[model samples]
Target chain A: MSNNTAIKIENLSKMYRLGQIGTGSLGQDLNRFYAKLRGKEDPYSIIGQTNDRTSEAESDFVWALKGINFEVKQGEVLGVIGKNGAGKSTLLKLISQITAPTTGAIKAKGRIASLLEVGTGMHPEMTARENIFLNGAILGMTKKEIKAKFDEIIDFAGCQMYIETPIKRFSSGMRVRLGFAVAAFLEPEILIVDEVLAVGDAEFQKKAIGKMKEVSNGGERTVLFVSHNMGSIKTLCNRAIVLEHGKLVYDGTAEDGVSYYLNNQNNASEKNLLQRTDRIGNGKLKFTGIKMLNKKNKSVNEIIAGDPVKFNIDYKTNCDIDVNKLLFGITFWDQHENKILGYSTDEMGITFSNLKNEGYFTLNIPCFGLRGGTYNIKLIATVGGTKMENMLDNIENAYSMTVLPGDFWQTGKANRSGNMALLKGSISQHNE
Target chain B: MNKDEDWDIILKPKRNLLDINLKQIYQYRDLLFLFVKRDIITTYKQTILGPIWFFVQPILTMVIYVFIFGKVAKISTDDIPQPLFYISGIIMWNYFSSCFSLTANTFTGNAGIFGKVFFPRLIVPLSQITSNLIKFCIQFILFLIVFFYYLNSNAITPSYLIVLLPVLILIIAVLGLGLGLIFSSLTTKYKDLKFLMQFGIQLLMYATPVIYPLSTIPAQYQFWFKLNPLTHVIETFKTAFLGSGQFSLTGLLYSCIFTTFTLIIGVIIFNKTEQNFMDTV
Candidate 1:
């Protein structure tokens, strides 16, 4: 309610009905009607659980978002970070009015345009020129406004030659660029962009981040951005909020928010990894536990970039089958779910023939080459050299490890703001 | 609470059922215009005949009606030329049916767009009605050409009541739009209505005086036809242009009242549905 505040959300919650969904029983409709007739609240909505996807529903309803409250100042670029199904998108959808909340309200200043997707409402049969107008109008731009900036949008997208051509013929990257170009020209006071940059190529992503900065840096526009990419969040957002299980868990500077999310979040690491039922495969061999160890082999989940580390994956075999050419692999994915580093015992031509019923695979690295960030570790155990490589166990997002910035090259300075991988090489001056 | 008044927008869990945002729809008039343009243009994108299909469609339907209902069934055309009588009814009924069916699919058909963006949801159905009107006008020209041919032979006479043509069209549009909105809202939750809508429109067409003149029906059943708002529209349209068929001020007045109520109720349900239809859809 202050003069500088652009948006204020008060205890906003969205409850969704689970199981036997959308069939819309007449009995329930009548129940809801009777409740309303008695001047009472919705009967089914009053009792529900939190928005946790990992657990079975205790009731027929689940709160997709619950008791979420935050305030964004004008000209502030706020990044919303959370794991999938953690209410990040539900919050954005609520703020953008794509769907209404079940309880509470959001009061905001000025016009709000959300790019929950790029080229939303664009017709494939329409020419690029036509889609620009259509997409622009869908994003709340007038025809005259689109016409005035038509050339700029085309130039920005770098598709002037294909402006007359239908966009269906364009490559996926070209379509993204064209869509982002029109959206960028929309000068709404508040902009909600939800992971639209994940589709475009690298150069276009850079241009999009720059445009977003320019829009917010003008001291007039407010932006709410949601993405799985933490690098963009740290660079583009001045402040950030983290939602976990539909609750506002962290709110502060973008740096602290990203660290808080990475440090406190892990899928099966907190509980006994052996008890996790989300794993998939033939289950002939199952991963019992995965641990990140320091040089002394002590368990540690956080390490510096240049530190020596080992990934110890404990497994147990189910049957007495002879294990021939068994492979143990561990893949490290960055925050964006891009595979940054992966190593398999078979890659080094060192395959075990007969594995014990219970054993552990240790992948040792003399120097951890990944830059400072959180990486998810996926464990896969397979038996090769016999009848088309049988996968025994595959556990995705089994563990999350935090990598701190360090002197990977021993240069006393850190390599930041670049690719996620680090390398060390020797250079000597030579006269040629 | 007073301080909250300054905010540009306030989103709440429940809004007034009657809180139809006409101002917002007006503000997004350009979107409506573009949607109308998109519907009309993309419909004939790769078709060979293009807009000529607009003419071919009604002409074909007229010929069929003339064959089945006129020659085979012996349905009366009130002594007017078979083509003119049927064409007049065909054009008017086509406009109503197209408006109803197209607008009825507004929520389900545009779910992809509706889910991603936030605009006045009313603009979509408004655009459907608008674009169908454009198609109707093109088909109306076809009707006029046939009307001129009949007029030269003294088979038909134009009345001053022809001035009410715009009013009659307005009633048909409102009736279709209203019922379409109501059905569209229902289809989002109960998909069974979608199937019902397909055959329901066909059956409703028979209940109105489309293939046969109002005189062909007995007086007892004619009252039931009058209960259908479209019957008055079709009757008034025929009486004004073709110089035969029933046209009553009271009947037109009854349609006006019926259309106004349907529109109000349709908008109420539509406004309610658009808010959270995405969740169900």
Candidate 2:
């Protein structure tokens, strides 16, 4: 590893056995122990050797993270972007020494502190003052050092009045603020943050991002940040790593990685629509597939800020069911679980008369004025007030679709205020 | 990389083993002191009696033992006054029991904090032991009051063995901590062990000669009594203060050897468990 490289991860892989859960048995423990003692590779190393699909899929290990290699230099701020279950948290946990990696090695320099979650080490009965020290100790800070910085931490958290009050009395925001304040002030050589900034308000978030920038710019520390906000990723990160299905899909400049992630998200939604049955659910009545197309009947993942789009849902009913009283609704939620828009057949004044066989339905809406961002479409099918199938289908990132710069609104800013863009109109003044 | 500039002191945790960094632990000693202070201060902050609970608990337990075992059961205190004898045993026993009980639940109790941060896990149990020692100190003073009152009345005389009180207390603390850690590690995997721990500690007090004098046990049962390391610790305490119980140097040696051995094993198991206990716990 180069001297400038703050972190070096080599062939890092993490495999968790599928269905062979509960920390494994004593026999399996001994088997693994003896295998390590004999210098043999993990008995479960052979990826597909234990694959037995018929017998409840035994003897197979799921690679939560696979053969990942990367280097982070001093003062570098790297963003780790991945979908849920993509092993982002696992990677941080391994680096922070919360858990050991099952395979490979990670070499890192400096005192590393990770804010994996907020209010992690806070004791409810302990006062804010006591918890500050307790939390400092848990983060590996010495008492003398914490004492030296105590006033600063309390001031930053803005909870000095309640220093002697138990933390249980603090609001969630206060708890998060205090937690972030401590972690940020720890001043470690390397900091790893995992989506914890999303906990606080926008003002605190801006402050935290600013602090992260300061920490990295100081030229002595490095940072690894993970967030789903592409805008923040683009603004905060110098480099970025993209993970897809437990694999390193891309690693490069922040712009390129963000673009790659957006493009991959586009493809994933398309692929998931094609293979919708594989999505986990009751599996009795299923949303077999879904497709969104433009007026030209072309399958388009991208659309203008205001344009016409058509949604087609292909579903199968296990048994004959009533169609007249059936309800088909679709809700669009942003990546952060923010609901942007929703519509149902009842609200649209469209209803099916009678249906006995499995089929497809198409809903078309014109002049959809959704702003640029990724949005998930949740399709719910209910009959006789009993819900059957509900699936959140990804329709390209609605918001991330590029909007040309010169319309009525200025395009220099990356994000526009409010929920969605509104048509702009102006009344002209005439002088005679 | 310049080796001299690099401050990489943390070692990767050894697999399938409990590893401790004594140096890093020492480096964080100030944090430990703060944690101990936090424990002591926050424990009494909202309570009515506050620090007096520390004194009241042992005194009340000694009074109850005096009522049930001395007056009701007519158990002999080996010709020693009931209050002084019971107070001595109660103080020492309460300290050991509290240490073991608290240490046994260390991992479970602190899982929330442990899951979030990376620190020497040993600091938690160490702080608990230290904090409990504060309580023990208060109760020990109360025990001293009873001892002096009896001495002033010419009812009992302390022996030269009283010099061994501190050493005996150290042995008892280590024994409690060791066994507590072992049980705590086990409880992470089997939650049922926690229930057993509460009942088991109470049952162990009966086996240890806390309420009854060691001399009261029949001669044939002496070997079995000696098998209990805590028995020797209690007997040593009684002999040191009340000056009536038997004091065998060989028994003290045996207890010391057992305490050391249990502690070593406890440290090993505890180190191993701390690594991935977050998962199981």
Candidate 3:
């Protein structure tokens, strides 16, 4: 470890037992004890698979994190990006010492405070003032430290009138603001944050990001931030690392990391969509497959921004009850999870009645309006005319597509880096 | 990494089984104080009676014990007034019981906070012990009121061993904390132990001489009763305040030794369990 190295992680790994703990642990413990007595390795430790939630367990143990090595320099803002089960949180938990790793070690300089969540120990019945102290103390701040920054925290949270009100009475936005304010002032040498900004209103999120930027720019503190919001990662992080299947697959600049993560999502569509477990619905109707087609109706992975394209969504009705008022929708979202464009059958007053058990719906667009960027598609099907009460299916990121830049306004120059969508319009100059 | 490196903290896969990290615990003393204050302040919040519940629980238990054991069972109260006798034992027993039960759920109860934050996990159970001590002090005042009431009637005499009041409280606390720590660590692994613990404290109380004097027990059964460390502490409490119950030096010494052993074993197991209880809990 060097003086400039704020955190040095070496060969860190964590293995978690699957299924029920303690049910068959006694035998495993005995096996481990026997192995240790015979001067051999633990029997169960050697047999395990990677952390993949969608797969069936072939063994009783899985390595949540495996042989991870990374170094964070002082005053560096490192962003960690990964899929849902890619061991990002496991890595943070290890660095924060919430749980000990199964193997390897981490050497850290100065105090390390992790905001795996804000208001971790806050009581709902306590006033905001009281909870601030409690939350600060839980985040490793002394009472004197909290008292010194009490006015600043209240000012930042902007809940001066509600300081004496119990947090239960405050709006959730206010609560998150209060929690984030307390955490922002923690002033630990190494701060680990995990998606805490996913909550709170937009204004508070901007303030929090600004606070985080300020904290890292102090030239003495280091920060490790994890979020699914690619926009924040690109804006707030100087460097980023991408984890895939419990392994560090990419370590580079934030822009490159975001692009690497977005590009990696393209391969996930190769799996049969029907077998996807990451969907939300009542299971009345399910999306089985999605095909992106160019103007000639030939299936293509990449679509030009100004070109005509079509999306064919294959679905199957689980039961025979669906008849009329079917609302089928497809939404396009950027890598930052911002909804870019949405098209629904009801928008054109088109309804499919008495749908077949297994059929496909095609949405044709004369001009695809998305800019040149990778986007994800979410498929939604509802029975009750665009109302969410009878939502049959909602699958987020069911399909990933890359759009190439094109002249949408018939101009020779391609319009890039303006916004997510391009609008078709003609402006006439007035002789004023 | 070289040993000469000036890293402030080195997190490792396995620490010594007995590593309790007293320095870390000391560093987070403010958190412990906050936890204790939270428990004390929030437990009775929004209630009409507030901290009055502290006085009500023990007094109600004393009244019931006086009726059941004093009048119905005809068990001797060591010739001390029934209310005076039972209240003293009740206050002492209440402190230990509340502390034991509360600390026993340290791992399972605070899993949310423990999962998110890194601090000395021992601070939680220690806070429970401290908060319960505050409650015990409040109830002791009620006991003293009853003691003086009996004193004016000249019905009982107080002993100079009364100075052992603080020592008696310390014994009860250590015994409760030790056993609670042991059970808390075990309950994280085997959740069924939690159900046993709920009724286990009740069963253990009968084995101690809480409602009756040690003299009421037969000679053959005295050894088993004496084996319970609480037996000596409650007996000494009653002997000091009421001047009627027995307080042998050997019994007190035996209780202290038992408490020390339990605490050492409890801390060892607790420190070991806190390392990875989040994974299982």
In terms of DockQ, which candidate is strongest? 1
Q: Write one digit per residue (lDDT tens) for candidate 1, span A1-432.
A: 358899999999999888875565668999999999999988998798998888888998989899988899999999999989999888988899989999999999999999888888889999999999999999999999999999999999999899889889999888888989999899999999888665566588668777877886787899999987666676678899999999999999987887677656554433247888987667788889887776656566776677798877888886554455677788999878899888887777775765678988888899998887788988887777323347778888999887766567776444443338887888799999
What digit string (tens of lDDT, one per residue) describes model 3 on residues A1-432?
365888888898999999889897767778888999999987888888988778898999999999888889998889999988899999999889899999988998899999888878899989998899999988888999999999999998899999889899988877888988898888889989888665666577667767877887787789999987665676668899999888888999986787677556534333247988887778888899998877766666666667898888888986654566778888889888998888887787886666678998888999988777788889998877655668888898888887766656665434453238988878898997
Better of 2 and 3 by lDDT: 3
lDDT of 2 by residue, A1-432 (tens): 367878878788766666534455556668878999999876766763222222354345766687889889989999999877777887888888876665677777878888888567677888898888877777878777888999999999999799989888988889988988887788788889887676567689777877877786687778899987666676678899998767888999986786666555534333235444434444434565666765456554554344467777776666445557666777777667787777877667777775644677687777665665556667766554433253222233322223211122334223432345445455689999
User: What TM-score against the true chain A does chain A of each candidate get?
Assistant: 0.71, 0.66, 0.68
What TM-score against the true fold does each predicted structure earn? 0.84, 0.79, 0.81
> What's the candidate order when arranged by decreasing TM-score?
1, 3, 2
Q: How accurate is candidate 2 locally (lDDT)?
A: 0.75
Q: TM-score of chain B only, all predictions?
A: 0.98, 0.94, 0.97
Candidate 3, pairs of clashing residues: none
Per TM-score, the best of the predicted structures is 1
Error of 3 at A49 (Å): 1.2
Question: In CAPRI terms, where does candidate 1 land?
Answer: medium
The Cα error of candidate 3 at residue A195, in Å, is: 1.8
Residue A4 lDDT in candidate 3: 87
